[model samples]
Target: MSEKYLIGVDGSEQSRVALAWGLARATERGADVELLHVADDSFLSESVAFLSEAQKASEQMLNAEIEYARSLGFTGKITGNAVVGHPIAELEEASRSADLLVLGAHSGSRLAGSFFGTRAVKAAATAHCPVAVIPNNDANPNAAVVVGVDGSEASKKAIAFAAEEASFRGLALVAVYAWMPPLTPGLEYLWSEELVDSQRSAAEEAIAIGVAGLATRYPDLEIRREIVQAPPVAALVQAAEGAELVVVGSRGRGGLSRLLLGSVSHGVLQALPCPVIVTRA
Candidate 1:
């Protein structure tokens, strides 16, 4: 069966940008595109007429997005679904069978409650498959793909996904591990260069373990390692300045298993430098 890529669609220009990104990827992989538009019925009254009108509007939006995809020369199979429900919930449910879930990053609003903002992160955190959040702006054509690495199952999955992406795109792969020295508040004098070096060494080891066999798997892909003495989110954001894409795990080693999204992932999503893909094992 052909691979399926599900995308969340709104009538916004950001969603159109995401549609273009998704269609280009689908065309490359010969995958079917599934466009989903969910009208936010949570705030609407229970009146049947109101719900009917909302559903009708959603269908129109979905159809327009489908036409947009066709206009972009995506010749593969395309499917559209318009539903009246919470956008995040519907997208999460629809992503179960998809190979990837794509969403638009809202440029005008903060990521808390904005459409396709926090909602995109929320869907990415819980989606069964990987989720790609495409920004409205274009990526740097000459930059490599960056992936966050740590000695965690989630980061391992991210490394694999990022390596595959870089190989397919014929771009370099940058695996980054950011570490900060553990300093006690009252014992600031105890912090020294030796302790910092120890932390750096540990970070290096973790990153090495995270990308153990990628060289054999992707012989042609150029892989680079980045060990930064900073916070994970800040380091990743900096590394993504000129990156084509950024890949990060949903959760990290320090994050609790019950945490759907790690602090780093959430922070990266909030300040997305480029199109970010949150991967899951």
Candidate 2:
């Protein structure tokens, strides 16, 4: 079966941006695109007439988005659907069968919350497959694909995904491993150069292990390594300054069982440096 990308559409400008990005990617990979619009009927559940009108409006919006996709010259198989339900629940359900879930995030000052006002984050955290979050603004035109690696099972999956994307796009791949000295709040006096160097060496080794056999797998791909002595979020956000796409694991080594999204993934999602793909293990 052809690959399928599920994109959430809400008639917002951000959603339009996501539609374009998803369609372009689908066209590139010869994949199908499914645009979904969920009309929240929570408030209007008691009013049958209002619910019906809202559903009609949602369908209209979907039709318009489909036309917009065609206008962008997307010739692949495209379908749109409108349903009455909670957006997050509907999207989560649909994403289970999709190869990818793509959403749009508002950029600049309008980012009051994470992409899609926390909905994107929730979807990404709970998605059964990979989730791609595209920002409203374009990424650096000449940058390579970037992936965060922490030698965890989840990050290993991210590395594979990033390598495949870079290979297919004919772009370089940057594997980043960020590490910081282990220090407690009141233990600044114990800080030493040796500790820093030890951490750096460990980071290098971790990254080396994380990217092992990648060259063998993607023989033609160019892979670059970056080891930064900073917080994972800061390091990744900086590395993504001009990145085409940033791929990260949904959970990291320090991830708690209660948290669906790791600190790194959640932080990176909030940063919105570029188009980010959060992959699951």
Candidate 3:
């Protein structure tokens, strides 16, 4: 139940696309929307007149985006803020009060949309709220909501978010849990059919237990479970081929200590087919 979203706007087509998505979600849930435009002062020219012009341009762009959203049938309360600061830090601090933060991927080919470049990734990793990275080429709005789940706290949070999204959109929820049975041990004694079957069964049970209460929470939402015996990143990317959205935990059970995002999540973010949400809780 995200009741508010803060979208970062930079006057780019991708940012406008993200605003559209955020506004649509806000309108659907009767939520409030906040548009934040961080005018990178570092990029501003040294002249005082140029600085004033840049500030005015940023504010006008924010206003224009709000008007554009309104024209597109968004009735939710829309507020705009044009500030002079670093975009990532500004967005991350502002995210503390917002239910979610929406950002746009860098402008480029659709295949490159998988990676949000530096700004999106920095804000997502440090934001206090969940971050939704919208790609530029999300032309088809109708696609299943896919989630990556494991028996971890972060994955459970992702499952809850994905389930709510599926329920709201009236779409099916595809829960994917990827596991790799130790098939690399070249010894025959270590690679048997029974062992692989047991591993698969355990993985399936984990997924079931992980999302046990989803049906009760979303009675009308359809839930589908898939167990992929491959690498987590590869399995998730393949599953998200035609999905409308992909959601995953920012980190997993064995996440690295140095980075905020785990290997699987990092890979999925870099190569998902559509918009991707990385949960912070």
Best by lDDT: 1
Per-residue C-alpha lDDT of model 1 across residues 2-53, encoded as one tens digit per residue: 8999988887888888888899899988999999999999899899999999
In model 2, which range of ten residues has the least summed lDDT? 251-260
Cα error, residue 211 of model 2, in Å, equals 0.6
lDDT tens per residue, model 3, 16-103: 7888888888887888899898788777777989878878988998888878878988876889898776777788789889998998
Worst 10 residues of 1 by lDDT: 251-260
lDDT of 1: 0.86
* CA error at residue 199 for candidate 3, angstroms: 1.3
Candidate 1 error regions (>4 Å): 252-260
RMSD of 1: 2.3
What candidate 3 gets wrong by more than 4 Å, as runs, is 43-53, 106-116, 183-189, 252-259
Residue 79, model 1, lDDT: 95
Q: List the residue pairs that clash in candidate 3.
A: none
lDDT of 2 by residue, 109-216 (tens): 234463375778888877778999888886676579999999999999999999999999989999999987777899987978887788889988999998899899
Return the clash pairs for model 2, or none: none
**Residue 9's C-alpha lDDT in candidate 1?**
85
Looking at model 3, report the run of 10 residues with the lowest lDDT sum: 107-116
